[model samples]
Target: MQQAINKVELRNLQIEDYKELKNSMVEAYSELKEAYWQEEQIERLLEIFPEGQLVILVDGRVVGSALSLIVDNRKASATHTYEKITGNYTFSTHDPFGDVLYGIDVFIHPDYRGLRLGRRLYDARKEICEKLNLQSIIFAGRIPRYAEHAKEMTPKQYIEKVRAKEIHDPVLSFQLSNDFHVIKVMKNYLEGDVSSQEYAVLLEWNNIYYEKHQQLINTRKSVIRLGLIQWQMRPLNNLEALFEQAEFFIDAVSGYASDFAMFPELFIAPLMADYNHLSEADAIRELARYTDSIRKKFQEFAISYNINIITGSMPLLENGNLYNVGFLCKRDGTSEMYSKIHITPNEVFYWGMKGGSQIKTFDTDCGKIGIMICYDVEFPELSRLLADEGMDILFVPFLTDTQNGYTRVRNCAQARAIENECYVAIAGCVGNLPKVNNMDIQFAQAAVFTPSDFAFPTNGIKAEATPNTEMTLIVDVDVDLLKELHEHGSVRTMKDRRKDLYQIKKLKS
Candidate 1:
């Protein structure tokens, strides 16, 4: 095999590299007096917590090192000295179950000053923190070279200058660039230290990848605003007229500052201009023909308005087969389709349409969501599967001709929300189109729902438009509150699921 040309590698420190490590430390910190760690201390650190000790090598030569130890943040105070915190460099305060990773030291050889080896060491420490599920990494970063400008400004003034990009301190500047924020300045942190003027700055980097058992709470802009439109039946006109109407509603919702705008199932029913002249089967096929053009327009609106839009559901034609599909258009003009997985009897007998075979969830900036059409929301298994896969919200677009038909979809939607502990929003078509044959009549009411828990609304209805009316409703749903309900609700529906007795697995694709 050819010798690997990659010169740099990171690995755990070994017991045999103490001599080289001592020499490297001396070469890296040559300007400081007595800065090298003792051989016994290095050996002890490797013996007790070898995983926390990392070494950087260039062609098998140890050129840099980073050491860390876990410490309980509760026991640490705002003004503790370095010697008191680390137990005189022995790290006797290391707690295995602690939530914070304390940085002991980091140094690179003089030859590796501009190679960014220190940044590599810091990234390695972050990787360790994530793997261990640590909350954050805290360190007493030095203001090295501050002694050169100590008489010119105080420590606070120096930090402000470094933050404002007016002046730079070697260690503090590097830490700030690496996403570390200064917490406070520690007095008498290191005795007799010329660098930092014997004062060290406490800094922290939160491990965002860490998974905590507690629910996540958001303090800033926690709600996702949704605009649901209950479209009224209109005459079958040209495609341009239909598109203009959709843009009208989308523009209206955008003015209200909605994050996501949703329409009803088959909201494009009025665009089927040639339906009355053809048979029922031909009419359904005609609807599929407009899928591509409508999809492009929907994406354009999403990008132009800078709002995410769901095209309730469209009649799509795929490889000579007709399917009821919905297009989710993101703010960047990207889109994905979700075909209705449960076919109704009317669709099967009259239109010869088949049900979709696959189910999927979409991740958005608002939240993780699953889209279901009219009849799909009536099935418990589909929504439960989506909830199990970490769906926090479910969107349903329905079309019903009678009050009884509307009640079925609305009741089942509420049941799914309660059972899954997920937010459910339903939008539907209203009014009647007498000349449109099968789509002549519609009775609907748009509603946003939530779980019937203390954390959520009491009756599970957040907002609802009147039945048999043309209207739009904009409501806010909190994703963080859904997380809270999943973990600590009055009745934990997700957690209380009896998985031991029954397992519902998705069929192989």
Candidate 2:
């Protein structure tokens, strides 16, 4: 679908369709006097299972088919580049693999020339590469060059002379138009065109092809302010009025990609009067309903605005037990939820609940991000585990006390970011929600953190709820930069890790 124009339907080649495809390829190869066509080869190809061999069909006929080569080097040297490149390297330059070595074989019936079936067949091959985990697909194709006139020469001399001939031709124009590079050439060794013992030009499609493949990957790199919108709201009553203050903040940042949005510790509270007086069973049941609703509503707003939201601590119920939680669902449908892995002594003492143990990270179209809850972030292991998994952005949602606790969390955030070479976001609830007996005080402000080893220029912050209001904060992420930090270059963090000695220590465990 990327830059497509024709109506060619591509599907796996069936055995029933094989007769037509093999017949077409053999005939096409015959034109060049190549001996690759044979009945024995067809039988071997059948062993691959026709369902896996793909065909490019137009109308009801098979115009093109790919004869793939499978090389399983599991019993031999398996880690070499050549072994990895051409899955199970079959040196046979005859049937399908030869075509693979020569690049994907595309023989459009001469009648279907202008229909653009060539590109469709190539896409089929790319899919094959993905299933096998091939790093990069390389194509080897022939370019034609003709000599001006014949001359007296010996067998080798004649072939060498023919190879020496050079011409700026039409197919050569076609190949270059498609971004193929001319790597080399030969004599009397290619399919189609004037053999006249003519020169065979070798062309390839490498990473530089750039023929509309990467166009769909949102490459827009505009700097946008992102907010860790943590609100200090007491509780949501009647869900509507409770959302009033939070909605006001979202409305203000509504128009721009730069907006502030957030959710605090238990944004919704039941009956708002005396929570402590309620039995634990009743309290947990009410919180469970609130958690499910919060997840649904939070997803809608994030998707509707195409914004980034770190929905703060909600009550998550797994089985019948309830735990505090955090979520970061981008404006897209992609959502990630993190249960509180570390519990405060007070919470455990009072609620008699356990904590989450695993650290989960989500890969977004934007970047690789991880979430840790309130008290869990204090432990170095939580962030360390996420860092080990290649997290580029880490979000920590907490219920902070009046001191704002920015410096405290920010310190931990900075440490984690520096250790992992990633960015960190910490959001905290801002107000006190008092029920019959006890007051649950949540800190109000959130902060953004970057690796301390590098310069941050204080990246833009989205509109977070102010000192007193509940709000939704939105921010744009610079995913491109995050990608760079993960890969190699001047500041390649992954490369900076000396895994040899580190692996020994880890292996001991």
What are the C-alpha RMSDs, in order, of all predicted structures? Answer: 19.3, 15.2
lDDT of 1 by residue, 59-124 (tens): 888888998888887655356888888888888988888888889889988876777889999988
Local distance difference test, candidate 1? 0.86
Q: lDDT per prediction?
A: 0.86, 0.55
Candidate 2 structure quality by residue, lDDT tens digits, 142-184: 3333333335543334334434443344345455545355554
Best by lDDT: 1
Q: What is the lDDT of residue 264 in candidate 1?
A: 94
TM-score of structure candidate 1: 0.61
- Model 2, runs deviating above 4 Å: 1-212, 217-225, 258-261, 269-276, 279-285, 334-336, 402-407, 434-440, 453-455, 458-477, 483-493, 503-509
Q: How do all models score by TM-score?
A: 0.61, 0.51
